[model samples]
Target chain A: MTTAPLGQLPGQTRRGERILIGLAVGLTLLFIAAPLVFIFVRAFAQGWQVYAANILHPATLHAIWLTTITAIIVVPLNVGFGIAAAWAVAKHRFPGRGILVTLIEIPFSISPIIAGICYLLLYGRQGLLGPWLQANDIQVVFALPGIVLVTMFVTAPFVAREVLPLMQAQGSEQEQAAVTLGANGWQIFTRVTLPNIKWALLYGAVLCTARAVGEFGGVSVVSGNIRGQTNTLPLHVELLFNDLNAVGAFAAASTLTLIAVVALVIKAILEGRRQS
Target chain B: MTAAATHTGAPIRAKRVLPGFTLSLGTTLLYMTFIVLIPVITLILKGAEIGPERFWRIISSPRAVAAFQITLTAALIATAFNAIYGLLMAWVLVRYEFRGKRILDALMDVPFALPTAVAGLSLTALFSANGWFGPVLDAMGIQVVYTIWGIALAMAFTSVPFVVRTVQPVLEDMDPALEQAALTLGARPWAIFTRVVFPAILPAWLAGCTTAFARSLGEFGAIVFIAGNLPFRTEIAALLAYIRLEEFDYNGAAAIALVLLAFALVLLVVSNVLQAWASRHREASR
Candidate 1:
């Protein structure tokens, strides 16, 4: 299966297969790989000293820190909800199962900017909870809370989607077996379910982390892009780019690009394991 | 045995007294409500508060209409390109073996993993008058950056994986027997594909296109950089909503956002239906 199954198809001659492979590879390199390479090229276009300085700049550090903090918080919350949702949907039959699954996927289809707008409609100064929040002197939108909440919203489905399929495919047979063996619910989940899903859980976590760190549109609308404060890496890249610091922007971007690459590598390796 | 809990799905729910069902479902509903459902509810309410007439007026404003037109046009173009490119990638990846195929397969997800803002920045820089591909195209009188083409390119870039990923599994799982029968019947390769293989993968391809189109409609971060955000030109609906928010025109923003939300919801349902149809199609055919 790993090798070419050429000549299996009526139209797929050796030449045709080569042509398609060349086209896929060439177009991918041009359209996909080139931009990734360009990020580093522009980042170090001025050489290591400038790239190093840009990477070490106060703005860059703050952005990285903020993005890291956001991911650190969002990833775990997503994982918790992910596990819970997967348990609910994949392991048991329920009345509103279809609706819950649909609701879980809503954020994926909605624009992140619209998600921010949704929050603004609920929690902004002139929003649904505006007067109450004002009375309490609490700031949600245009702040760190807003950034974290929106990131959570945008990435909420990643972990659940990943783990649910695995759980559904594996089914609850093991858990049912544990129960027949007189294992309690907690014991069953911990001893049987968790062990089976650990890889998918990690896969989901990796995707969630990647998304939480890179979230921008919603964060931008809600963050107010305060330098040395609320700007995450993605926002900061925009800020630096707008400031005419293309080099610095790409320098900041290179970090995220590296994270993305690492995440993909991990995902690919995990996928290989699953297939094997 | 709780009769009510088991009433709807009587057979299965009766047997599995799973430990975490209530607690897990409760957590999922509560979290979804606070984080997603409630905010969305408020947005719909806000949109409703404007009344249909006002909402219509707001969205039909000349600039708003233009943004919708541009976004739709660009998203359509992006979806079309991805449809072809995705099918090609899936077909090649599944049918052919080549050096670096795995690497290329892995690379398909770069757009997914890469931050949209970075993609936008890199694309903008690369297509600007001085960046890598700019001059070569410029000499041919082709300009990409700050145009609808740029917007479509960015959208296509961000959504590249959707189609390939969706269609790949379907293609891989396709039964060889059907094609073999077609070949034994003296069908040409094109006929085999069109009559046999293509029917098998149609639902999945359509499902992928629906999602890619939905994604293109909502795309923001990646497009803003390359599109130049010119009013009545490249400004997408999402960006327009953001602009209204920035201007403190909450009513206007809410009105426009409601439209985009509607599009998303409809597309989500359509995609789900297509996914179901695809699986059923596979089961029946297999």
Candidate 2:
């Protein structure tokens, strides 16, 4: 038998339900759906040849490559940290646990532009570490290293935040059981804990990858916007837009939009896996 | 029920068995210190080098004050819209059944997944004078691009999922029996929502709103394109800091960033406290 919704009683008219649903659908269409549709529309506004050329452009290719490399390096490091942080916080009780979580979450609240500025202060030629770096003749800001570092900083908390909750809820019972049965730490983690938490770990990595690939403000600050060099896909979009190349900008954006959609689809599947 | 286990004269702690506590916690702390902590310290140090007087002067300048005002105003406007829109969206998602609900749910996270620059670009294009919504809005005397409203729109778009995600699970887990009881008591739907439902989700909703506001304050990418970046007008505090850095005015950049950083830290603490209080309240009620 079908049960009535909580706020919907027999006394409520059908018209009221229709209106509420209509408003939500309409606004969602305007705010969320429309932008998504327009991305593709604008991307192809100049037709097939232009869209193909924009995507195949050398600068665009370099941007996609740079974005890929950044995500490749950033996601694994953050995922490793995520697992370690979750293991520490969830499996064991310790003093200052609360503080650690807050530290991890600092990036979520701070502006990305501020994150880039902070990196600059440490690594810029005249920064605190500037003299040391100059003596070493090592460039951090306005380079690939700077881009990676800031992306790492901005995305540091993703995996740990996602995995920590699931780990906490699962507790250490299975791990304890494994230890009682003579499993070593590595063995227990690999054979028991990994199988259980793998979905969450992957979920976090998906999000981290998406964020790393799309990072803009922070990366922009440090990358120096060197065309065909330190530029990423997101930065390329900005560069294209500012150059009055709206079609090319939208073309680049449509690629990122496609990536986002893929990420969401994967995220949805993982959410289902995680629930079951 | 079985009797509770009695404690011995001296409480005995369980022997630690899990490996990697030291290894794991050490890596976490060391990585965090290097990646997150040290950079932040440098920013603070950079700001401190300006000395109190100069820091004050830099932040109190007309341009700086105006940027802060615009940032706060736009953030407030964005947060206000998200507060109502978020609640309604959450309510609809949780309480109503409709086609494309799954798609709608997935789309809620686009703002999170989509790159900010793309969001900014697409939004600007969509709302610019010659674009689709631009003409409609322009004809209606409602300009979005390069205006405060545009900034707020971008802010709201990018932060759409904050409240929805936070409040969704809470709404899903809420005890519907109370609402059913209220309905049987002959209460209006609005009354039931206000009295019976809203209270249950109030802490989560507030926490969500606060986080959304903090995010709006820090937002840079989605805003810059649409905001027009007009000095003392569309320019936000973050953009001002970026401009300072571009001019090699490290001191000025640090001073402004320090203000934004402080806002973030305070809001972080507030959001954390509200979340803790929410869980505690839920536990207490249970």
Candidate 3:
């Protein structure tokens, strides 16, 4: 009764096997799903007023602005880098091509905290160029420029990594044809290659934006976390939590959670499109 | 004569077919050098400035060594769990057709998209004394928040997706006919899995686990919330580096940071090598 192979021996999983699969699924959902649900639940635990108040706080709004500005600046720059790197590495073969491709991926493996530390060393008051920067009245560390730079460093590889394989797979056939047809460089790229890799490019941009907005470790190191002045939304969440404002912290966290959800939705759609 | 003329002065050369090579490659190289490469060089230079003896002492300091120990141990524990859990998740995903399966598959990327800070906050909230799991765990005398377990938990949450994502495609592409043949040969499910399926997926799975381990080692935002950041106890290397920077001990911070960077760089090299070997093995077998 317990083990029913029935008519489908190869395809049909046994009951015990089914139970094991079910438990795996359940545990995964619990471990992964529960934390996501808990954030929003805690945010609204004290009803709408508390949630609204925390979210609308002046410092929170500033953090939101800083986070948005950082993403706005970093994502497009990384997108440009991604496209350029992908094109150079994928379309044309040259000496050190493999090294170039590998170098492009270096950021993916590097830790963001170390990235933040690197910038601090390069631009901080005590850094290699710190004295020069100080003498020149330019602030890189503990300021907006430092935050943007580190964010750029952390997110440098997203677009290139996403786009390279697609470009490589597509090859240079269309490009060669377009050249035969008398298309100029920009025209061929705009007309032929751009259309092909647009989806992957968008996928990379979305991912870049997600990381840019959510970046905490690197930004935290350089941003000085000076409340409204330097805190991005993630840093703001940390600040609020550290301030013992649990509700405020969760509310801020909910906003990021919302962004992450939207990004995931777009990602899922793009992935479906990529497959089909 | 025609070949010489074509080679000498053809207006449309094959090499020139895709123009902007120099321009694009130049920009890419420049950007990478400025953003990624230069910063790392500067860190190394800074580390170099600290005499070797002092640098050695800084990294080998009791606090520094403990942080590395905690980080490596926690990362290993988390990766071990992900190895089992992630493989099970991928297997369920690829082999089974069930209700909410697509949703489950889509949900696999939630960790990748979710902010680590947000993840840490929620996990900490759930496991803290007054949080959801807190009450249950309190009764059982188990503490997650502000402990090494919490550090491992956060790392596990953030890095689990690496294994699942890596293993899923490999499992999906596997020829089901192999499994069928194994079954027909009087092989039990366990034997078939261990002998047939495991071998094929081992390389990819190992790569995934290595990536997860490397990622967990560098994780900062998530672990800080749950880890309690106590020195020599729950403090991770990354956090300790940040603390050193905070205290204006640049050499100490740089030395610690270099050690972490070295670990990440080595793991990445190992991972690339493993992938190459895996592909070569696959090709030879084919």
DockQ of each: 0.65, 0.63, 0.60
Worst 10 residues of 3 chain A by lDDT: A1-10
iRMSD (1 decimal) for each model: 2.7, 3.3, 3.1
Give per-residue CA lDDT, model 3, range B1-286, as digits (tens): 2234235554545444577788889989999999998899999999889989999999999999999999999999999999999999898888777888888887788888999999999999999988878889889999889989999999999999899988887887777667767777777778888998899888889989999999999999999899989998999999999999999999999999999999999999988987777676566444
Q: Model 1, range B1-286, lDDT digits (tens) per residue? A: 3334335474665345667788998999999999999999999999889999999999999999999999999999999999999999999889877778889888899999999999999999999999989999999999899999999999999997999999999998888878877777777777888999899999999999999999999999999899999999788889999999989999999999999999999999899999999999889877
Alpha carbon deviation, residue B144, candidate 1 (Å): 0.6
* Model 2 spans > 4 angstroms off: A1-8, B1-15
> What is the two-chain DockQ of model 2?
0.63
| Model 3: lDDT of residue B215 | 98
TM-score of each: 0.96, 0.96, 0.96
Clashing pairs in 1: none
- Tell me which residue pairs clash in candidate 2: none
Candidates 1 and 2, the one with greater lDDT = 1
Docking quality class, candidate 3? medium
- Residue-wise lDDT of candidate 2 within B1-286, one digit each (tens)? 0012112222422224577889999999999999999999999988878899999999999999999999999999999999999988898899878898898888789999999998999899999987889999989999899889999999999986999988898888887788888777777778988998899889999999999999999999999899999998799999999999999999999999999999999999899989988787677545
Candidate 3 stretches greater than 4 Å from native:
A1-12, B1-16, B284-286
How many residue pairs clash in each candidate at the backbone level? 0, 0, 0
Write candidate 2's Cα lDDT for A28-99 as tens digits: 989998999999999999999999999999999999999999999999999999999999998887889988
lDDT ranking from best to worst? Answer: 1, 2, 3
